[model samples]
Target: MKAESETKNQKADSTELDQSSFGLSALNFKLKIGFDGKRAANNLTGLGNYSRSLIEHLADQFPEHEYLVYAPKVKSARQIDAFFEKENIKLKLPKSGPFLWRALNILKDLTQDECQIFHGLSHEIPLAIQHTRIKSIVTIHDLIFLRFPQYYKLIDRKLYEWKSKSACKRADKIIAISEKTKEDIINLYGINPEKIEVIYQSCDDSFKTAFPKEKLSRIKATYKLPDKYLLNVGTIEERKNLKLVVQALKEVNEEYKLVVIGKQTAYFNSIEKEIEKLGLKNRVLFLKNIPFTDLPGIYQMANVFVYPSFYEGFGIPIIEALYSGVPVVAATGSCLEEAGGPNSLYVSPNDATGLAKAINQIIENPQLQKEMKEKGLEFVQKFNSSVVTQQLMNCYLSL
Candidate 1:
């Protein structure tokens, strides 16, 4: 009797889903999708960029589908106002409260919204929603905390590991940003490789466009940029290994300056100490709070873009440099090669001398620089928004 009753219930649930899908199809409507936009709404780092760009591209490619972004708080109207203006996109903020309350509110909203699919743009999903019928997907950017435990506090690493492991197990589908990330997920978590989808992310479209000469000149003057400089962008964190670039500066020609952009952390103090010790105080410039609109011009004006990070899921800065028609010199032993492509030069992460040589090679050889620029531009086409969006859409449709 128990088996017969369970079978009946399963059949009923299957019929219900079929009826619901058919009803939506009849109405010419697509699945209602929800995204965790905490990073998208507040942070401007790689996770935030990924969240924003994915949503923008998905909306542009598939306008018929509804997108609901759930966040703890909507901090800036300007940050998401443009997205809200679109008919198919809506921003859902939690009611005033603490973390648990806000999380419960978001879960309630997801259920009430009747979201057919809920995508955690980062490595998290509401535990409350696991019982719901909503299909869950999570994008696991990297396992950096697991790989480099020393770089993170014990408690933080434990928290991240728990969240990531739980999300990978709970998600109906896993989106890995790179092949390296996908492999890490499989090996670390023992997840079946078939369950994960690899999708590459493109930088902001702004990088692909060129600013007028007068505007570029104005930006250069406003920033007080040198005539020629090697550029490095990313937060001032040890994992980024920016000290290698500073060390490389000691070996490079005196006329070649090094410009570092991105937020400064405690690590900046150590890097500054090294710069002073090497007598490169004036030659190495550290910039903070650079306007987003000015980054493309800065990349275009660069003699070479150096990314010596010890590891990454995918290097957006390299792609940005590629889009901006700049030669790239990135480190090996991670996904940087995938980001920099075949034409860009790569050196060992800790090899300051090799980095210096690569930078000088590009700087002195105009032909090599032009070749890298051309090849990178061609290589970057595979990551275009239209291409990536379609791949993401296919993942959604499969579910």
Candidate 2:
């Protein structure tokens, strides 16, 4: 009797998923999809860009499904409108404090929107909607709390860990950005393998090839960037391992500058002090905010792109560098290997000597650089938006 009852429950859960209501033409029973994001469209870093690109593809690929983008404020909504103007994608920005806004918006989405699935782009979701009818899915970007507990304060770490564990437990489905991230999730939260889907992200269309020499020259002059420099793109954070890049420059004989591009964080003082100590004031340049459209030109002007990070869930800049047709020197292990593939020259993360040796190898050998650049372009095609989005659609449709 118990075995027969268990089979019936399994049948009921399977029946709850309406297979006929999939794809764009199923407007009569369209799945109202709600995406939660905190940042504005233009303020996109790794998570923000993932949300932007994935959501845009979702809107285009499945036009029949109702897509509602829930953000914290009108500024983000306006930015979304400007960035992604798809007819099916609707932006909802509530006028309230962050906490209350998330609470009220989530409550409304669960009750009124009649959404079949609610995806929390980040870890945190609406705790208040615990008893609501909407099914929940969360993307665990990384296990930063477990991986690098030293970087975050005690309260932040504790809260993040708690929320992440809870989300993993409650989620109907989970999406892991990388395999390493998936492993972390399994180790930390003990989520079932079948419950979590591994979907690798892709570079945006903005990171592709540029126009003719004339247009490239205009963009190059506009930014006042060097014709050739070693590029490192990411925030000025300790975990990002910017110090290794600084130390590597001392070993290189090349005259090309090292350009560090990203916004300054609160803890950038140590990085600044290190640069001053190294007497690299002239050699190291900081371009804080480069326009989004002009990033490809900046990549075009680079001799090589290096990412010596100690840790990452998925390093998007490495993909951008590869897709931009630049030779890369990324760290050996972790998600860098997954992103850089077998074509990249790998070096130890914190070893300045190893980084310097890799940089020297690239600079001294012109043919190696050309060959690596070709391989990078070839490797990057596997992670194109169209391809990754189809994987995402497959996962969503399976749900």
Candidate 3:
């Protein structure tokens, strides 16, 4: 602990420790790696962002290594434009049968490309990946469907189970995004705990940027944001528990409104109905379809960030909030505590009163807010991009 502490003080960042500290300074390992790049190419969801961030940062940190992105189809979009142009990262697609291409291309493309390691950025790797000589890894984001069965339809649950189990069975190593996910894999799927590594995820680099006051003001005007508000980011699904915050809003300080930013689901109908019944319709603001570029400013403009999700594999929004210098208030049931650290407050997902108390505590006290913000920013360095990328590289190097 002393050595680590001394190292942290010596370097500009903890992750910038001497490469020899990781036993990698002398090793000249330049690997050719492949990925199930669909998440990076075709998704704007959690899985998509995870793939894009990992790939892009890996390429940036280890420039000598070639990172091949294998996608069945590539979406034409602005956010994903970086992958197409990044050095050491190449996008590969099949000639035909786009749906079958990912499953069918593994043996051919990986072997032909001389890939030494193939990573499934989400849960499933190629079914035929085991047949080849390349070592394989799969990142299991969460077992939410298995953990909370009621939320998913039976057929969807079964399909997710099959894919996850197959990937765990076929992968040489399992990288769980959180310790809870690792435990779920072992408990639900009976995977060996020894084969699984807990690797946390980093939020986008944009969230860490400090926007100029003029830019922040422009964004505030564009969104028609309230003078001071609480922020929540995630999909508006039942498991996410956005309703908990809405319920708390009626009891918290009258001056602070709740700003909700996320994609909506049918569950939102119930949330809307509850807001209407509570007579706090004007107190809650919903920002749907906000561009990713505007997200950092939104987080920076917040008075506090609340994510009362019932469960998660790893809470990236918590990390984003910390990077934005906002204190976090999250649910206690899952990995939210890990993301928020000890200084940030945690309330039971079901306790609207406790949630309101925690919110008022942060909102009403300036010193507490400042302490949480400073300590939160310090705590989130563990999920720093360089740190996570190095951990991932070490995992690959272990093989």
Candidate 1 minimal-lDDT segment of 10 residues: 18-27
lDDT of each: 0.85, 0.77, 0.88
lDDT for predicted candidate 1 compared with the true structure: 0.85
lDDT of 3 by residue, 105-187 (tens): 55687788899999988889888788779999999999999889999999999999999999999899999999889989999
* Tens-place lDDT digits, model 1, residues 138-243: 9999999988898999999999999889889988999999999998999999999989999999899999888899989998899899998999999999999999
Return the TM-score for each candidate structure: 0.90, 0.87, 0.94
Top-down lDDT ranking: 3, 1, 2
Candidate 2 Cα misplacement greater than 4 A, ranges: 1-29, 40-46, 76-78, 93-105, 128-133
Model 3 CA lDDT for position 67: 92
Best candidate per TM-score, number?
A: 3
- Ordered from best to worst TM-score, the candidate numbers read 3, 1, 2
Worst 10 residues of 2 by lDDT: 16-25
Off by over 4 Å in 3: 1-27, 95-99
What stretches of model 1 exceed 4 Å from their correct place? Answer: 1-29, 95-105
